[model samples]
Target: MLLPMSTAIAQRISLENHLSLETLRSGAGGEHHFNGMCQAACIASLLCEAGYGTAREGLFGEAERVLLDCRRAGIETENWRFDGKSYRILAEVLTLHDKQLSITPVRELIRANERLKTS
Candidate 1:
């Protein structure tokens, strides 16, 4: 029988199995591993480099809210492509919430995504 997991245990599991930038870049697990998940990928990279607090500071909540709002507004949060808007919005949110975060990587990722879209 499958039992429900406690929040603490679930959190630990999530922390341990974070998706990395390399994974996003290589798509080793799948070609679409990063499809429509740019927001999550960004947060995971930050958490991997910094710590859980980087996400706890506010990014997760803000990201969730953005997704929810998009859904409510009947916007299809692309499930087959990189979400550039999410990355851009997340970069801004990071600036507001965590001053110590290095967003250069995020900016670079955004540029890379843009190039992929154009090419």
Candidate 2:
């Protein structure tokens, strides 16, 4: 059950769970144009951090990859909208890695590092 979360929350979670907003906001593949690109952006971030050049090179390409991988992983993507898919993709990525980080430190890091930029 991937619930739609606020964009603010999604941004924080991305920074905490994976990469920075700068990475997700990349102009690759014209991904920022779509409304359902959050999940793709998160996937792009993950793949980029994992040293995948193609993922770092584009967003929608990564978006397509996410959808495909999700299907292969027995997950669905039709329900994602707005910022909803961000959490869904992030959860899947976490599960793939068998890793977890407390929300507390992430929040603190956001407050200390990212909040000022947004504010």
Candidate 3:
């Protein structure tokens, strides 16, 4: 599977530039599983941003840690089911688990959650 620059390097790449496919996927090999597991991919990207690791190794290991982090941060995750489509799960986890994150990746999710309260 082909992959573009990571969430980290993506900031530097010009969206207007016509990057070659080879350049985009130059270093890709076994670390391209984002399409099937959006949550995992987001978590992996977050972990990398948090100084965990670059390569997406040990999916189960990363998942275990993410769950633990959620629990430690008092985020209720027992009822959470990963359908691999909703990135909101990832956003919620990150938002609640660590309020220190710079990027608000789930602004829409936040608004939706708020709307549910006033409705």
Q: Which candidate wins on lDDT?
A: 1
Q: Which candidate leads in TM-score? A: 1
How high is each candidate's TM-score? 0.28, 0.21, 0.19
Off by over 4 Å in 1: 1-35, 38-56, 75-88, 92-119
Instruction: State, as a TM-score between 0 and 1, how close model 2 is to the true structure.
Output: 0.21
Decreasing TM-score order of the candidates:
1, 2, 3
The list of candidate 3 runs beyond 4 A from truth reads 1-36, 56-119
- Model 2: ten consecutive residues of lowest lDDT: 27-36
Enumerate residue pairs that collide in model 3.
Answer: none
Once model 1 is optimally superposed onto the true structure by TM-score, how far is the C-alpha of residue 54 displaced, in angstroms? Answer: 3.0
lDDT of 2 at 40: 33
- lDDT of model 1 at position 43: 44
- lDDT (tens digit, per residue) of candidate 2 on 23-100: 233322222223223443443344335433232244444455654543333324332222336434444444432222
Winner on lDDT (1 vs 2): 1
User: Local distance difference test, per candidate?
Assistant: 0.41, 0.37, 0.35
